[model samples]
Target chain A: MKDRGLPARISCGPEGSNMQYGFVTIYWRDMIRFVRFKTLLISSLLQPALWLAFFGIAMASNFDAMMAGMPVPAGIHSVGYLTFMAAGIIAMTTLFTSLFGGIVILFDKNWGLMREILASPVGRNHIIVGIALSGVTKSFIQALIIMGFGVLIGAAFFAGYAPLQIVIGILGILAFVALFALGFLFLSAAIAISMESPEGLQGVMTLLTMPIFFASNALYPIDSFPEILRVISLYNPMTMLINGIRYFAIGPDFYALGHHYAFTQMDIALSFLGLVVFSVIMFVLAWWRFRKAVVT
Target chain B: MVQPGPAGDDPIILVENLEHTYGNFKAVDGISFAVKRGEIFSFLGPNGAGKSTAINILITLLTIQKGRAVVAGYDVATEPQRVRESIGIVFQDITLDRDMTVWEQLEFHGRLYDMPVKDRRDRIEELLKLVQLEAKRNELTKRLSGGMKRRLEIARGLMTRPTVLFLDEPTIGLDPQTRMRMWEYIKGVNREGTTIFLTTHYMDEADQLSDRISIIDHGKIIISGTSGELKNTLGRDLIHLETDNNEKAITLLEHLPSVREITVRDTLIVLMVNEDGTRVLPGIIDTLRDAGIEISSINLKKPSMDDVFVFYTGKDIRDEGQGPARPHFLRAGGK
Candidate 1:
């Protein structure tokens, strides 16, 4: 029989440490990775900028009826379809930015980078938190940048609660980031490991990305869709997110929960609660699977 | 009669009845081994040998199927979190976030171990110097070469100053120059009194670095001993000669009392012998010549890990890949 009772438990120096600082370490690396990859920055400006310049203008003439059908809330007016489109565009930008960030986690898995983190002394939950925090950070910056572009294009809202709005925006970004990152992190880690192939990556992306982006309130309002399509859109978590962000950004419009000049704090709170629950579930499931992946 | 080492010193690591299976295939069979603290223990096996699986279990990367593993007094399965908290692992593939610079990557790992901010800074700096990549601290890991990236990984593993450092095929793909440097780094880490448990298929590597090595085959520990002791246990030195007529050569060589084991094939005669090979070389050649056998070529090569593997399993380690074996998880849960 061989004895593998390896002696030496790792010493930071001459003294033994009794603390938990892995979260900070993991978070720092994750943030750096997200920035260095440059995925969000390029997509952030390019996609939304294109939508504002081309989609909002070229199709502006045809979208009149589409805008007319949306019930404009009190004290808010859509002089053109582009005005109605801006909120959805902004929300879509956050949705896309947040959702696509999920795939990058899969990319990391394929490259064996995740194994490095898994093998570390870092707690599994901290690893999830670090990645989620980075994802949330990227989603917020991208959403804010898209909002700036919208403002440049004459998109106006009831400019009163800037602090509350910023807080709401952050809360929305966190909600979206937590849900998308956790779900996708679990998915990507699962796929890369089980398949261990990049060939079917695009198929997987389309399978997940298409349904969320199209079926949700990204391109059109949920009310404008057919009966069956409306049901699908209304049920989607992305629907809750896109609608919530829009109401907060422009305040009570056809998109608002009520036909009044007001924003619902309860809606934002609901999305937060929903996403937090999802984030916890997904995070726990992914961590458990990963902890068993390459080590044993 | 065989005598074992005195058990006066408690083992640094002890694995009892370790086994891992994926479906019907047994990647790591019932294997057991112990590593002493401050010792460089190498798990030597070829391509499909359960080396990686074994190391993974030790490091807590792969879950142990049916066994007991204790590292620095921490149980691997029950206290996996604590096992991970204490162990440092340098995986075979690139594990550092390639998007970040060397400093950022190391800093992140230091924090993962929960090292203090001030302590993390000192650890990262010390690690950079230890891996000889302090100058490239600011450079992105994506821009580094294979060797530099490997060194960076080793440095990252040490960021935690783990009690037992696990390395999985650490130098498999590196160039010769890089492999030598990596070997030195491994030696240097071992010298720091950090116990290292590594897996590799390279026999020369096992001979050069390991204070002791365990030979694993098909998930089983066939033999475990130091480099010299294992080779000595073979009882004779193997002299594999490629000649024109293997049959006639073996027939003549079989008479020599010095020859303990002999394997003959088409144009090769592998003779495991003791004493001087040259003392009987003259007779071997004369007997072949008198027997009208054509001597086109004759080359003698020594037995090594490969020979040792074949001697036990009746198959070469190089052939492990071609068969249906493939890569199997050799040990328990991950690092």
Candidate 2:
């Protein structure tokens, strides 16, 4: 509905030399598109908001001892467990949104729109970056909104933490988003070119989302579970992600780190590096896979 | 529709011994051809004739498994990005986001190519008008008719004003009138000197347009030439005489020197003529008359692109596609 006046020329390169053009504008234009698609936009937010409101409140009473062992200055978990759940759940929203957001990539393939994009003169990285940014921005917004909802409900957050926690939370969320974006984006392109039905996209999302969700600590802490479950949870990428959020949200505590190492910048840096390594590997794979997907 | 010039000038596209293999099936067997700049080249084949595969290869949608493909003088394999830059492709499947409007769709693509925003805006408006879709510019694409969606695809394909355009089964499932409307727009684009390359199975569509065509079957280009050139190369004008029994007619025409080939096709003894049709008509009439066969009807059909296809490959083009041929039918009477 806004005035879309004469568009500015987004030169692919300097003038002369039969320069190619138009890639940057499409990327920017897609950001506006992220706002227009209501169903897709809301679906990202709805999942987390639901978990925060209904599940967090309903399940908190059950998580009492789970919180009692938290070993905060408070003697028992009490309401603090629910609070811990709230912060962790909000971060998990980013995981769910960005990972499965690759479903959109598959949708693009099935409809043959990816062909239109790839056929253009635009650089492949430009397209990849644009979609990644949108997916991250969508997840980040939902994460923040969920955070607010959590506080409003008296989520029992263990506060008095330093302001630096914001950096940790944001960096952690962005890193997780980048890693999932790269990983699932590759998978989406792979599934897309081969996909014959809309069901194929759904089937793939179903296959991926569950493993990543239950294997992580968003729903519960790692130590409460059995030995095998604890090992699996510790190794799970989302486990590390939720731990990062947990440490930042609740100051150093025994519940998350199993010791006083809770607020260390070291853990944040390690998690960030791990996610970055995963991101780079996935990115290279996606770049190669997409190049193959487009040409095939 | 005729142009007077040497035919061998720098062809806008060139493919040499191009081949693709998906396991044991050779979808495109070593085939070579070229299209002159500004010529409307059509790849006419039944559904599985690998027409789509070839289009994919040319547009850089599929990789060439063997040999080489060059478009606008850029090697598709070695310099695919450049090849992508030079061509615009409209796939048979509707690829536009149903959630995005016509204007938004074009703008997103403009940014993909990093068009100077100015050029992108001007091009979008020009194309919206070109497709006669300026009125629906802000409307969601989901509301568009089958024909309108196709027109949007053409507009989308041309947003970058690609030097070469690849349309794979553009009109697959529209009503007759809409099909014709699509053809009209396609012709207009071709007239504007866009080197148009498309693939379709509709017999009439192939005959109606296409300055040149390549007939592919099971991944091999069995034949390639202008429609007339390919038709004339069949070396037979069909003579359909009203014969109650085709076997008797085939036997009669088989021994005749002027008759080149005869086949019982479509309940008619289709006779191929080696002699000039004008000269041989009376003699054939006299011969049939003496046989006590009353002439119920007589018709001659210079081979259509369909005939050229049937002559080279022993199958119809429409049998193709796990994809529904529905969209192709939309263009049937559209032209």
Name the candidate that leads on TM-score: 2
Candidate 1 residue spans exceeding 4 A from truth: A1-24, A37-42, A59-80, A159-199, A217-219, A253-296, B1-7, B236-256, B280-306, B319-335
TM-score of each: 0.82, 0.83
Can you write out model 1's per-residue Cα lDDT over B1-335, one digit (the tens) per residue?
11234568667688999998879989889888888878888888876677788778877777777989898888887666677777788887777666778888887676656677899999888888888898999998889999999988888777777888888888988998999999999999989989999988777788788988888778898888887777666544555566666777678778877777776533456666675666655666777788787777554444465566556655555656553322111111101
User: What is the RMSD of candidate 2?
Assistant: 6.7
Provide the TM-score of chain A alone for each candidate, in the order shown.
0.73, 0.77
Lowest summed lDDT across 10 adjacent residues in model 2 chain B is found at B326-335
TM-score of chain A of 2: 0.77
Candidate 1 per-residue lDDT, tens place, A4-88, comes to 1221222121123343445466556666655565765576567877887789866665766555577765555344656556656
- Predicted candidate 2 versus true structure: per-residue lDDT over A96-212, tens digit per residue: 666555555666766636767666655555455556666666666886777667778876444654556656655655555556455555445445544667786778767877877
Chain A TM-score of model 1 versus the true structure? 0.73
Residue B202, candidate 1: alpha-carbon lDDT? 77
Q: DockQ, per-model, please?
A: 0.39, 0.40
For every model in order, what is the number of clashing pairs? 48, 51
